[model samples]
Target chain A: MTATVIDGRMVARGVREETARRAAALTTAPVLATVLVGDDPASGVYVANKRRSAAAAGIGDVHRHLPGTASEAEVAAVLDELAADDRVTGILLQLPLPGHLDPARLVERIPPEKDVDGLTTRSQGLLARGEPGLRPCTPAGVIALLDAAGIGLAGRRAVVVGRSTLVGRPMAQLLLGRDATVTIAHSRTRDLPALTRSADVLVAAAGVPGIITGAHVAPGATVVDVGIHRTSDGLVGDVDRAGVAPVAGAITPVPGGVGPMTIAMLLANTVAAAQTREAAR
Target chain B: MTATVIDGRMVARGVREETARRAAALTTAPVLATVLVGDDPASGVYVANKRRSAAAAGIGDVHRHLPGTASEAEVAAVLDELAADDRVTGILLQLPLPGHLDPARLVERIPPEKDVDGLTTRSQGLLARGEPGLRPCTPAGVIALLDAAGIGLAGRRAVVVGRSTLVGRPMAQLLLGRDATVTIAHSRTRDLPALTRSADVLVAAAGVPGIITGAHVAPGATVVDVGIHRTSDGLVGDVDRAGVAPVAGAITPVPGGVGPMTIAMLLANTVAAAQTREAAR
Candidate 1:
């Protein structure tokens, strides 16, 4: 029997619709500010998609582009300006800033309230402590997907195969917060299959394409793939979908699974930031 | 085969000696300030032990005691005063403050540099991201114990049976940082033994006395018991020593095990905080 496909686009659309409702409810529309450091084609496409999505969700969009040779101070100045602007509700800094600039230092400059991507140290700390604050979008999106699918996490054995700060680590924390017994396995893990097979809910975020196949999954277990790689064989995810789908109970597909949910959650965070700022005012 | 008993007192002595040397090397003596609210006998004993250990490690000690009726603002004022005090190298606010007062709010008030206990959100964030910062003492102590025992954690399966902010959560992060495959099981976990028996290194911080027995251990696994309970039979930890010792390769005993290491690490953090402040100056 084949597995039930967890459609991310459908869930993300529901999220975007809810976000639009909230955005419309606000007297002043929430604004998402995009900061692109270089002219990398892929980064440009990603930024443009986010801006268009924000607009569709009834959120205002403000885009700032920096030359490929932009200095750290120049980027910092732009962030400082957006951070101080009353119209800007949330800030998304396009990543992989030319190799010369430090991402951590620049990301920390975005005020935690305005950090829609939730990459700031302050935001990370809030998530670690289970405090009420913006969370990293991808992991938050994964949670939204799971909730929409009606999967119960409490008392479940959830294994996250990857330990990235962005996805794997925070994913484990979110699952743990939901009362799932969580395990995090990384590059140094021993007997990878033996560990992954014990998972009732498996999350693959190793950034390595086709790393998890049928042999690694527990029979009838729910699988969530968080990796996306452009290969000669078209786009592929961390999990080998064809091999694992028939064995697993449910699985999220690449491109349509975790990808769309990310931008959707960013819109939700933007509206939440606006509501918080307006409440404080 | 009998398990090797990890000698915490011996290891702690060495740590304190090294900490004293560092404290002496600093131009100014590092000072640890303890804030105790209410007069709980157990808390008083805990604070006294820490203060005594600080003096033994060549660290200065300052103590403040508030009556049980103290308000939240009163505790906040004390933390504020200590935060601004140039002489206070580290602040240790005794836990279990009056029920009316909020510990999390007060803990956040202490500057991250002076937060020796590492209970603040900022410290937790730094740990979650694997950045350089002071970590929670108990987990840090457990790591030191494992290091002193010459147990290599890389590529090992380490299961932590607790999800507490002070110990369990940070313990998993520390193990993950060392490249171990880490799993955190809490009360909501299914089949505790099945999950725990897979660990090469098992940390029992469940706060339940003798909850783990021989049935829960794999042959020749390293076990670190972090619970301390006073009972009719005497002091007992989360793991039943008589039951698990024969099955385990190594184990830390109660009372003289993790307890001594906690105070030792606090002293070390005090010196480190002083060193950081001095270096910045």
Candidate 2:
């Protein structure tokens, strides 16, 4: 049986439209400032995508670039400037900065209120406590995709096959917040199939290409693939689509699945951040 | 065959001895200040126990008592005073303040460095990130108990049977940090026994008395019971000792298990907080 494909691009569009509506309704247009360090081609492409989307959503966009050799203090100064700028509603720092720079130190500097990516310690703390705050875009987008597909999470056994701070960890917290009994499996997890086969909702975010296949899935289970690795065969996700698609009841395609939702969620978060500041004022 | 009883009291004593040594070594005597709002008899007993333990550990102790009708500002003022007081190395506010008070707001007032209880947002964030920071006492104590027992957590299947901010959530995070494949089951979880029975290490913190029994445990699996309930038949934990002991490899008994360890970990965290402050100076 062929599995029903979950269309993430379509779902992300609805989200972007709503974000645009929100941005249009605001008294002052929201501004999303992207801080890019170094000239990594991939980082440049990602920041440009985010900036273009923000502008399309009726939000102002600003880009701050730094040389590869920029010192920690210099990057910190830019963050301080953005934080003090009332016009800048959200801050998005392009990651994988030059190896010499400490990522955690810079992440901590993004004021929680303007942390659109929700990577700050304060944002994570709020998520841990089940408090209302901006959530990490990728996991938050995965939830949006699940909801859009009408997946019932309450009382379901959901297994997240990764534990990275960026995606897997926060994804489990998000599932738990939605009342799914969540399990987090990683490289160290023994008998991965046995643990994942018990899941009603399986999320593949292990970052390893094609780590999940037909044997690892439970029949009729919903699979959300969060991995995208550039392989010889173009791009593949954590799940092997060719092997598992027939066995699964529903699945998200790698390239168009979680990818589009991420940028859409970023737009939503930026607008929400601006609305919060406006309300506070 | 009977399971070995994990002696929490013995382990806790060892920790307190170390804490005392550290406290004695400090240039200025470390001080722990506890704010008790309202005269909750149970809270009073708990505070007194902590004070007695602190004094025994060579740490200075201070207590601030406020009437049940204390306003939010009044409680905030007390916390602010303690936060500004250089001599007070750590601060703990007794839980379950009068019904009129907002606990979160009060808990937020405790400075992260001085938050000996480790209930603050910053502490939880640090725990989530697997960074160095004070952890919630009960979960930290659980890890201490596991370590004392020489339980090998790496690559093991660990199931946490709750998701409370105070215990279950942090417990899962700590176990994950130890390289255990962690699954969090809660009240909404289905097929609870099937999930719990799969665990090589099962932690019962569901706060439901006798919720976990022999059927929920895998043979020879280590069980840590974190629930304490007052009943006519004496104190009972989430695990039915009579039912689970015969089937388990080792277990922590209710009164002598987690209870003593909580106070011990609190002392450890207070000393650690003091050491951090002293190091900065």
Candidate 3:
């Protein structure tokens, strides 16, 4: 069967439009404080893209960059200020900050209501209890893609490759919330291919290029690629598209599959963050 | 191959002796407060057993029951008072309260620092993040029992049936921490027998009698029964003990296997709470 490509860009555009409408409806623009510490070009580009996206979604209350040498105490203080500020509805801390700053401590400073990235301990607790909250963007994007692909999660077998807190762990919990039978696999896992073959739905989040191939896919399975790698040739996903496409009933293409969905969910979370803060008021 | 019969009562004595030794080393006894709502005979019996166990462990400061008609606000106030008091190192809230009461809400009210049962969202978050914190009793007890029975969790294939927050969910997390390849099975799980046949360690927390049988167990698989049923046949575990024993390497008996271990861990948590509070001072 020919694999149906999941169109993340189009879905993201639709999401952006909705966010724009929601932003316009509010008296104040939904502000997202973007904290970027280091001059890592990639991080800079990513942060810039987010600022543009947030602006496009009508999020105009922009708070930007801090120097790489900023002390941990200073970063935490900024987060605390943002948390206390009634004007700022969302906080986005650019990751891979300087070696010295404690990301967990700084991230925890973002109030649970304004934690659009869903990185706070409170957010984790809410998700663990299967309660509604602003969920982690990337993991939430995978679910959004699954929905777009018309995959039924109830009673389905899902194997998530990688067990990172940002991806695999939350993804498994999200799947379980939808009543899917979920299994989490990591580097320490034994017989990886054997475990992969049993999955009716496979989500590869190991961040390694081409770790999941055609051989690992169960025939007629829907595979969502969560890995992104850049090589001299081009970009690649965990799954080898050419090798796995033939066997997969429906598969998400690397560049277009899960990527755009992440941005879409980020917009969604920011809107959700706005609503959460609003609801509390 | 015959299943090893894990003696929970014997293990409990060992744990109590250790607790006693720790108490002797301390300048003062660890104080634990027990909060019981309503006079359900069964709940009263359970609380009484906990108090007796606490006494045997040389634990002190037992607080008596409050009334059944306690409002949520009232309960929260009481919990808040206990949490603020330095003398109370640990707190226990007996279950199956009045019909109108929300158990989750009440459990959430207990300060994570004083929650010996480890039922709070904070504790669950710590578990998810692989941080060291008090764990839910039955799940923690399961690991302790396995350790006492000479079972090392490294490289084991563990299958946990059911996913309740108290038992199965935390049980899976603990097993994963121990380096076990864990799979959480639930009501929606298909081909359970096939899955169970490959398990090296099986835990049944479905609260259903005889859900796991000899046929489901792989030959010489270690089984830990978490379900306790009070049927016409008397108290029984989720496993069909007679049929499963011959094919299993080790098994925990229903009434004795995991039951005593729960209270043992409770005592352990209380003592740890005391140490933590004192150190904080």
Q: Clashes in model 2: which pairs?
A: none
| lDDT of every model, 2 decimals | 0.94, 0.94, 0.85
Cα-lDDT of candidate 2: 0.94
Q: Write the per-residue lDDT of candidate 2 for residues A56-168, one digit (tens) a residue.
A: 99999888999999999999999999999999999999998999999999989999999999999889999988898999999999999999999999999999999988999
TM-score of chain B of 2: 0.99
lDDT of 3 by residue, A46-73 (tens): 8888888888888865675788989998
**Predicted complex 3: DockQ:** 0.60
Winner on DockQ (1 vs 3): 1
Residue-level error in angstroms, candidate 1, position A148: 1.6
TM-score of chain B of each: 0.99, 0.99, 0.97
- DockQ score of each predicted structure, in the order shown: 0.86, 0.88, 0.60
Best by lDDT: 2
* Clash numbers, per candidate: 0, 0, 1
What candidate 3 gets wrong by more than 4 Å, as runs, is: A25-28
The segments of candidate 1 whose C-alpha lies over 4 angstroms from its true place after superposition are none
